[model samples]
Target: MIVWVCYSIVTLIILQFCILLIRIDFYWKNHRATSVELPFVSVLVAARNEERDLVDLLLSLENIDYPADKIEFLFADDQSSDRTAQLLGQWCEHSANRSFISIDSSQAALYNENGKANALGILAEEAKGDYYFFTDADCVVNREWIREGVGSFSGNTGLLIGITQVKAERMLGRFQEIDWWLTLGFVKVATDLHIHTTGLGNNMVISKEAYVKSGGFKSIPFCLTEDLEISRAIQKKGFGIAHQVSSGMLLKTKPEASLTSLMSQRKRWMHGMMTLPLYWKLGLGLQFGYFMGIIGLFIFMPKIGVVLALVKMALQGLFLHRFAHRAGERGSWLYLLFFDFYSSISTLLTILYYFWPSKTNWKSRIYP
Candidate 1:
């Protein structure tokens, strides 16, 4: 009796996941960037301790093909103890429209801000463009980034979310890359289906109107995931959110090199994830628990366990194959097995660490 009940639960988990995979949406399928308006825009980034990969960002910025006079760039050094400020100073000096801000104890305290939130809030104040584009210092964007991003906007779209992938040659890096796409797959589908989509700060765009309408970051209370908060605020202002999954808008970012670093990253995100809707939270929780649940079935009923696990993997592989193709990336079959194992362990640890009573660690700074 107990054995049958266990098999039933495990089967249900995979069934729900299959439905999610089936529902994953792609914008590139029927919709393409068709906007005719060319508005002035601001490219903004906030960095602390990003000196290591700052050059990559600089090179990518230089390669951008946007109009010099029409677009302005703002880079902020959030009190980095490294050469992040020095590098930005040099980069910003090359062009009149490019500038960087340094946040010191006085400025940060005056705003009473969370690091990233404070930095972006300051940047928004100085931006004169019609649109604000935001990315991370560790990301590599293509020449068409600005062009494609701007083109994807419809008149009603107050916010646009672009695709961001982890670029790496190592196995661990590959795992993170797969993980990113998988998560974004769900986000894209939910968003297109009219479900609320939280702002993804790494590769995101916001119109000045929506930014102001949402009262921007400064008006909101401090939170670790400023992106999530800002996105919700924008939606509340009755603005539609647009998502882009095309190749031209694809953005690549460096992966965390170590498990310790990866955990810290996930911990920060999971903290923000608490703001997710109940169904989403439950969906994500069950997805993480699927593997552990299978273990119980494997003990109680070996044949059924083996069959369900294999079927789930095959379904996921097929889903990701389509997902990767759309993102202009190559899909891997073997990664499906390894990813399940990796996500299971990491997710379990993240849950434990999330409630273990410690401030979230990010960019070498601790936040409560």
Candidate 2:
């Protein structure tokens, strides 16, 4: 029984990996950018207590290669108690195209949402653009970010996801950088296949029409990860979501301070996915199965487990290395070796927290 079960799981894993490999070719088939008239874009940043990294993001936006007249920056400060508002104020004063909104806890209550979603909702309403580019305040985007990202938008395209990279100097930070590349790589492939995939809010662009049609953040049900919910909502309306994997369009973010904080972040993501549609639920199950299958094989069928584990790791490592190099992430292959063990442990722990259901901390704001 154990042998059969492990064998079946390994077979499934291989099948999925094979599909991902084929979809990767989808990236190389088209090396040219689509030519479309550039539309005005509203860059949305919803921040709370992000004083430390906000200025870096502001400066990066100022450096984008896109025309300044065609772009506007909207920052929603969710009742920040620090220098976040002050910095935003200073940036907006010198720039005619930049604006900021202050979101209070009372407004979140009135909107029937939490901090981030509430802030995003307000920004969406106040925005004046054909495209809405959502990003976190702690991230620094590339100069061609808008140029390349917006270039991908043809009429039917509702969403475009830019790849994420981590700027980390510490060992733990390096682990996070590798882990995110692996995770985002899977997201990219799944997206290419038109399968259900959650997007990183820090680097996503959506058409304003799709945002309104999918029931803008205000109409969409409140969730910890608003981007995932909005993505699903947009897809359900038959709008196409695309990916931009070019290194030049990458968005860089800070790493978590500690393992504990990292776990907390994972728990939040797990919780958010748990509320997704049925197909998304199956996708999450596949991730869980991939991790547990190797463990079960090692425990019940040692000889087969060692051989299969090595095979699986090699396949995943090579694929991730290629993707990392293409996406301009360095030292990713070394960290891929540690990703399997780290992911298994982290996924199990995060699932536990997801089920327990308690208030979580994000940007110093506690959410239930």
Per-residue lDDT of 268 in model 1? 85
Clashing pairs in 2: none
Error of model 1, residue 263, in angstroms: 1.4
In lDDT terms, which candidate is top? Answer: 1
TM-score of each: 0.94, 0.93
Among the numbered candidates, top TM-score falls to 1
lDDT of 1 by residue, 1-368 (tens): 76666676677776765776666543433235565567799999999989899899889989998888889999889999999999999989899999988988877844435888888888889999888999999998878888888887776788989889898889999889888888887778778787886888989899999999998877767778888888888999999887788787788999999988888888888878887889888878777667666887789778888988888777777777777777778777787777878878888888887888887777777788
TM-score of 2: 0.93
